[model samples]
Target: MNGFTRTVMRTVLQAIPTILGIIVISFLLLYLMPGDAVDAIAGMSGSASQETMDALRDTYGLNDSFIVQFFRYLGGVLTLNFGTSISYSAPVLDVIMERLPSTMILMLTAFVIALTVGIMVGWAMAVFAGKWPDRLLTSTSLLLYSAPNFWVGLMIIVIFSARLQWFPSGGAETIGAALTGWGWFLDRLKHLVLPSCALAAFFVAIYARLTRAAMLEVLRQDYIRTAAAKGLHPMLIQFRHGLRNALIPVTTVAGMHLGNMLGGAVVVETVFNWPGIGRLTMSAIAARDTQVLLGILLLTSVVVIIVNVIIDWLTTLLDPRIRS
Candidate 1:
C-alpha cells in the first residue's frame, strides 16, 4: 500500500519480462548451436553405430521438431523441472544446487573484500585529493583494473602455494584433512584467500575509481559546503554527508559486478580450480551438456534480476528523489 511497497512490487513485475527474455534467448541460441547433444555424447564414447546414435537422439527427444522441443523445455522450466543433464545423468537443478554454495562463498568473500578495500582507499583518495597519496592510490587502482584476474590468480598461487606453502594451490579445502570446528573453518578460509583476492582485484579498481569520482563530485555540492560552513567536524562532514551521497554510484556498480560474478567467475574459478558453478559451466560447455547449460543460465538470470531489483530499492531508500 505504501509507496516503497508499490515500487518493489512494480519492479518485480517488470523483471518478469526480462526473465522470460533471458530464457527465450538463451534457449534459442543453445538450440541453434551446431551439433546435437546426442552426437557429442556418442563422440565422447569414441564413435557408435548409427542405430545407437539414432536411438540416443530419440531417447532424449532430440528428434523432435525445434518448436516442439523448445516449448517442452520451456514448460518444464516453468514447472521448476530443468530436466536431467545428458552428461551427468543427474537433474540439472540438483547439479547446480550442489555447486552453488562454493560459488556463492567465493563470490561473496570477494565482494566483501572489494567493497571494503575500495571504499576505504577511495575515501582516502578523496581526502587527500591533489596530493601524492591521491596520485599513488589512483595509479595503483588503475593498474589493478588493467590486470587480468586469471593472471593475478596464477601469480598468487605461485607465490603463496608453490613458493611459500602458505595456502593450498587450488580447491575448496584440503583433499583429506580431518579438520573440525575451528580447524575446518580456518582451512576453508585459507583456501578462500587467494581466489578471493584474485577475483576482487579488478572489482576493487572499479569501485575505487567510481567511489573516488562520486566522492569528489559530492564534496563540491552545495550541501557539503553548507555542512562545512556549519562548523561540523571535517570527518563527520565527509563520512556522514559526503560518503552517503557518494555511495549511490558505488551501489550501482557493486550490484552490476555482483550479478556478473554470480553468472560466472569463470576465469578465477578455472584458474584456481574452484568447484563453483563457473567451473561446472565450463565443463558443461565442453561436454555440450545442454540441459545443465540452460539451467545455469536461467539461475544466473534470476540472480541478476533479483540483485538489480534490490539495488533499485536500496537506491530509492538512500536517495528518495529516485522514487520520482
Candidate 2:
C-alpha cells in the first residue's frame, strides 16, 4: 500500500484501543459521581419535588443501572450524540463546536509564530556555534521556559495594555461591535497579540534550544564535514544537509508541542478572556456542568490521539528510517 493508505490504516488500528480506553474512563468516572443529571439540573433550579426529579431522571434514562448507563452512553457516542448539557440546556456537541473555531485560530497563530521564529533564532545560534549569540539565545530560552506563564501574562497586560495603551487588556472584542474591512481584522489581531505572546513565548524558548542542539549535533556528523570539504557553499551545506537533519528532532518536538499548545491554551485564553474551549471547559468544571466537562474531556482525548497519529506519519517523512 501507498504511504497515505498505510498511515491511515495504522492510525485506525491504534485509535481503536485509544477510543475504547477513553470511553471506559469517561464512563466510569461520570457514572461514579454522586448525583444523576436530573439532580444536578434540579439543584440549579432551586427546588423540584422528588416525583418531578425522578420523572426527569427516568426521561433521561438516568434511572438505568450503572452498566446500562454505560452501554447507553457508548451507544450515543457511536451515533455522534454527545447528549445535552445539564447546565447550558443545549447539546454538548453544539456548545463545543461553537467555541472550537476561536480556540483553533488562537492556537494556530501561536504555533506558527512559535515555530517560525524559534527555528530561525535557533538556526542562527547553531551557525554561530560557540559565539555569544548561541549563549544569549540559550540563556534567553531557559529564562522564558522557567518563567511562570500567568506572571508573564500579567506583566504584558500591565506594560503594554494598561500603561502604554497599545493593546486590549482582555476579551475577544467589544460587545455589540461590527468590524469594517481591515479595521475589524486589525482589531481582532490586537486582541490576539498579548495572549498569543503569552502562549508562544515559552514554546519558542524550548524550540530554539532543541533546534540549536540538534543542528550542532548534525553539523558534527561525518557527512556534514564531507559536504563542507567538497567546497559546497556554506549556505548550501547548512540548508540542504544540516538543516534537514536538524529538523528531524525539531519535527518531533514540534509535534509534541503542537498537541500541548492546543490543550494548554487555557491559561492564555482565561487571562485574555478569549471565547475559546479552554475558558468554556474551565467554567463548566467550576459550575459542575458535567455534560460540558465530559464533552471537553472526550474532545481533548480525540485530538491527542489524532496528533499522535499525525506525528507518526511526520516521523516517516522526516527520517525515512521510520518507513521500515
Candidate 3:
C-alpha cells in the first residue's frame, strides 16, 4: 500500500501488544487492591448479608484463581465486552461511552488553548530572549506550571466564576437552559471556559517552554540564516521557516502528553463537576468498581494510541527528514 497507510498500519500493529500488556497490568493492579466490586456494592448498600456478598463474589467469579479471572476478562475484552459496572449497574462500555464526549470536549479545548497560545508566547519569548518580556513570561510560565491543578481550578472559580461572574462555575451545560442551535453552543462554551483554562494551565507552560527552546534552536540553523539573508520578511522568517521546523519537537512532546492529558482531566472534571470519563473514573475508584475502571483504562489507552498514531503521521508530514 501507500506510505501513509503503511505507517498507520504499522503503528496499530505495534500497539496491540502494548494494549494487551496494559490490560493485564491494570487488571492485576485493581485485583490486588484492598477491596473488589463486591465490597463496594456491599458498603454502598449499608447492610448486605454475608451470604449475599458471597453470592456476588461467586457470581462475578471473584472466588476464582487470579489466572482464571484474568483469562475470563481478557476473553471478554478481546470480544469488545467490558463486563458490567458494579457502581452504576450498567455495562462498563456503555457507561464510559455516555461520558466520553464531555471528557473529549474538555481535553480538546484545553489542548487547543495550550498549543496555540503556547506557540505564540514561545515564539515571542524566543524573539526577545533574555529581555524583560521573556523574563516576565518565563516567570509566569513557572508559576502556572508549579500551581496545583485543583487549586488553579478553585482560584479560577473564585475569581472569574465566583467574583466576576463572567462564566458558569461548573457542569457541561446550563442544565435546564434547553438551549439549541448557536445558543446551545455559546452556553456550553461558557461552561467549558473555566475548567479548560484550569486544565490547560500546566500544559501551556510546558508547550511554551518547549516551543521557546525549539524556536531558538531552529532560528540558529543555517537554513534560517539563509532565509534571512534572502531578505524574507522578519515575521515570515520567524514563523514560516522557524516555527514550522520548530514544531517538530513540540509535536513530539505533545504526542507523549496525550495519555497524561487524560489523567489531568480527573482533577479538572472533579473540580467543575463536569460529567466525563474522568469523573466516572473517580466514581469507579471510590466504589472499587474494577469492571468500570478497567473499561475506562482500556478506553483511555486506545484513545492515547490513536492520538499518538495520528501524531506520528503528522510528524512525518511535517519533517521531510523523517519521511525520507
Per-candidate Cα lDDT values, in order, are 0.88, 0.83, 0.91
Q: Which stretches of candidate 2 lie over 4 Å from their true place?
A: 33-63, 321-324
RMSD of each: 1.6, 2.4, 1.0
**Collision count for each candidate, in order:** 0, 0, 0
TM-score of each: 0.95, 0.89, 0.98
Residues 1-324 of candidate 2 have per-residue lDDT tens digits of 977578878878987897888778877887787766576667778999999988877876777897887787778888989888866789999999999888888887888888888888899999997899888988888888998777888889999999999999988875678877888888888998889888888888988888888898999999999998999999999988988888888877887787678666888888889899989988776656666777787887777667667777877887877687
Decoy 3 TM-score against native = 0.98
lDDT of 3: 0.91
Rank all candidate structures by their TM-score, best first, as comma-separated numbers. 3, 1, 2
Give the range of the ten consecutive residues with the poorest summed lDDT in model 3. 1-10
Q: What's the lDDT for residue 125 in model 3? A: 94
Error of 1 at 59 (Å): 0.2
* Candidate 3 Cα deviation (angstroms), residue 3: 2.8
Query: Which parts of model 3 have CA positions greater than 4 angstroms off?
Result: none
Better of 1 and 3 by TM-score: 3
Clashing pairs in 1: none
